[model samples]
Target: MATNYNDYFKKNNDNDNNSNNTGGGFTPPELPNFLNKPIVWIIAILIVLAIFAKPFVVINQGEVGILSTTGKFDPEPLNAGMHFYIPIFQKVYVVDTKIHIINYKRIAEAGSMNDTRGGIKLYPSINVLDSRGLPVTIELTFGYRLNPKTAAQTIATYGFNWEDKIINPLVRDVVRNIVGRFPAEDLPIKRNQIATLINSKMQEKLDKLQSNPVILESVQLRQIILPNKIKDQILSVQVAKQQAQRVQYEVLKAKQEAQKRAALAQGMAEAKKIQAQGTAQAITIQANAQAKANKLISESLTPKLLQLKQIEVQGKFNEALKVNKNAQIFLTPGGVVPNLWINAKDKQKASVSK
Candidate 1:
């Protein structure tokens, strides 16, 4: 270790003078002779090693090192793992390349409300005037990451204030501007569209800030706070729409039922018409059969059949003639049958003759 007096340059000058005065093969100054002891040399060598190793850095996974000389960031950057630089004349700034999550909402997870690990709640809600001139509060969370390819550009452009100066301000401006274009009722309906718009807008601004881009992975719109009256009105409108749909469905169902009954009635009427036609056809067939039988009988009649019929009538007349003297049975000259006859003039003459 250099003492306060030695650190001031006086001791360094004296050492250089003594080395010039030695006039021998380039022997180190008196300090070396004093440092000749094993322990002293060991300590000196260790100190020298430490100084050389001071600028050596092991950049872990997902980390990049930016070289800075005399407080000026170098254009070239170092990748992960072991690297070396000039000590006291140069320094390295380590930046994480992994994604960073920043939440600006107070809404918690399902169980925990105050978990600090969730995220830092900066300004929770963004107050904006919507399209309808109504005030709406939007709660949101956004994700970003330091671009690894152009580590030097990132460090040079924003250093460690990328989130505050570039990302945060741009987010506020884009989100507020976007939300203002939508009405209070439309905000919730267009939440996804709003988030995508904010992400794209913010990305455009952040990309312009540095050659290495800070990518916005996503933006989540948590909640839209609106007045209770507006919510109730929206609910009523939804209910009315539902009721109208139900009525339409019932009307359609009744129409279908009426169609079904009409089809049944049509089928029954057709069946009855068919039955009536069938009955008329049956009666016609029976009449045709009876006419055929009567024609056969009339064609088959003969003289012998007529004589048999006359004999039957004569027998019946004789049976009646036995009961009364004035009655007598007889046949015509051609053998035609005289069945029965009553004459008032013949009855008077017959009684006078008797």
Candidate 2:
């Protein structure tokens, strides 16, 4: 039976092979390649070239660039505009060339007006003596700017925190030194002069620093403080002095008025005396004129005028006798009338004598 089965299988295989040969033959389609190694390498090289090329950076107006080579400072600086630099090795720092302002105030430890903390706090108390050795408190403000060209040099010489190292110390020193020279009273009255002095001192100190990174523009005294008790005392004294001055002025005015009145009285007395003298002199002159006229008339009288005067007297006597009941008459031979007498008894008598 095994032999019969093997012969049957072999006969079936030969029959199938004969059938395929008699039928038409079939073929399979080919697939294309997606990626090649040379193409991939070319794309990578392009990407690397783009990154290595140095790119330009634009610096804006009113700005200066600080160039550094390999993390170190470059001797030359770049001005405002587009500038080229090594992408990996060179670095650029931009600094503003224009002026800048900063404001600082002194604060207390507990932040109160009078409280003070230890070790020179942000807003610290300053003690100074005046000409009178009185203690005073002072507050001040100042304006400053960074020097553009010397910024790097300043930082290099005085460390990166140059504002704290150079600026703060110099301002503190100048303020204290200037304030120390004056008294509490002068601080308010001479504030402008004090500011000028501080500014001059600050400039001198800045010049000595040699860094030239910071410039002191101006200094101002903002506030002046004094002990309350002392202030009150000074005010009271000033008031008393002013009152005394007012009294003195009133007295001076009164004295001037008195002097004017005295001068007027003296003038009136002098005028009256002159008028009396003038009146007396006029009376004397009139009396002298009348006496002269009387003397002239007496000197012109003569003997003929005397005889005429005698005859006129005799004629007046004769007229009188005719009306008189009692009359007496006497005549001389030189043309004089003889004596004649008429009595109340009706007796009449006449005498003729030589």
Candidate 3:
């Protein structure tokens, strides 16, 4: 039972050697005594970890890495991902390539470069003199981003404060130059033109700069603060224009109404004339038909037929005269027919006449 552990290991090693020699089995080489130490294994593991992990940086999205050796920046920028640098001899500077905004506003409460939200910087609204020497305030927002291709050169030339040197000054200068070209009263009216001019001028200047460090995304003109008297005058002009438009609309409406009434009256007069013409035409046609019928009757009459009609009328009158004794008859040139007749039935008058 208390057999020495060292003897057990030695015996096993001796058996392994014998098996390897006789049975032709392969044996592993023994490690050195120094290698058996736990500290040496731990040191090797740490060395491997340090090589892979230390003196490295992970560049996030929308960012580029600037590598500088001893104080000189590399021209080509490192893209987003892990980057390696030599210890103490090299360093990496992360420059943001994402779009950023600079808002020139009326208030100054919004902090400067320290603003953490989307790298937006705020400055006081630009105060400039108009062509008339009147004071004006200009409010606007500028959008831009560092050119990733020339990020290193941009940083080298302008440093980390590239926005101040490239963007801020350029924007202010362009705004002042463009705004000062016009009178204060015209600023609000020519806002769009002013914005276009400022954008083009700023972009032109930026492109002309060495290496073109910043890419101009947008330049928006938000507001133009004019003097109070100019504001009042503009307001008055707007009111006058509205009144003129209203008057023109009313005049047009009246003209339309008058035309409608005239049309209605003309339509009524035409209808009455057509109705009168139709009535006259109908009367004329009826009279012509009646006259034609009478002519036909007259043409169909003969002497014999007239005599027969006269005989029939005489017989009817004779019968009538027999019933009324006081009846009197008068004949015409055609004596077979009575032309006039009277019946007087007063008895006293009949006696007197008889």
Best by TM-score: 3
lDDT of 3 at 191: 91
Alpha-carbon runs more than 4 Å astray in model 3: 1-53, 111-116, 291-326, 335-339, 346-354
**How do the predictions measure up, each by TM-score?**
0.62, 0.54, 0.76
TM-score (C-alpha, index-matched) for candidate 2: 0.54
Q: What shift in Å separates residue 10 of candidate 3 from its native position after superposition?
A: 17
Question: Residue 261 deviation, candidate 2, in Å?
Answer: 3.4
Query: Against the correct fold, how does model 1 do in TM-score?
Result: 0.62
- Candidate with more favorable, higher TM-score: 1 or 3: 3
lDDT of 1 by residue, 56-113 (tens): 9989988889888988887766787898888888898898777677666544342333
Off by over 4 Å in 1: 1-53, 107-123, 270-354
Q: After superposition, how far is residue 42 of candidate 1 from its true place, in Å?
A: 7.5
Candidate 1: which pairs clash? Answer: none
What digit string (tens of lDDT, one per residue) describes model 2 on residues 21-108? 8884442222223322346557888678656764557778766777877877764557778998876688787766554433335564
Q: Any residue pairs clashing in model 3, and if so which? A: none
lDDT of 3 by residue, 80-119 (tens): 8999898678999998999999888876566654454658
Ranking by TM-score: 3, 1, 2
- What C-alpha lDDT, on a 0 to 100 scale, does residue 321 get in candidate 1? 65
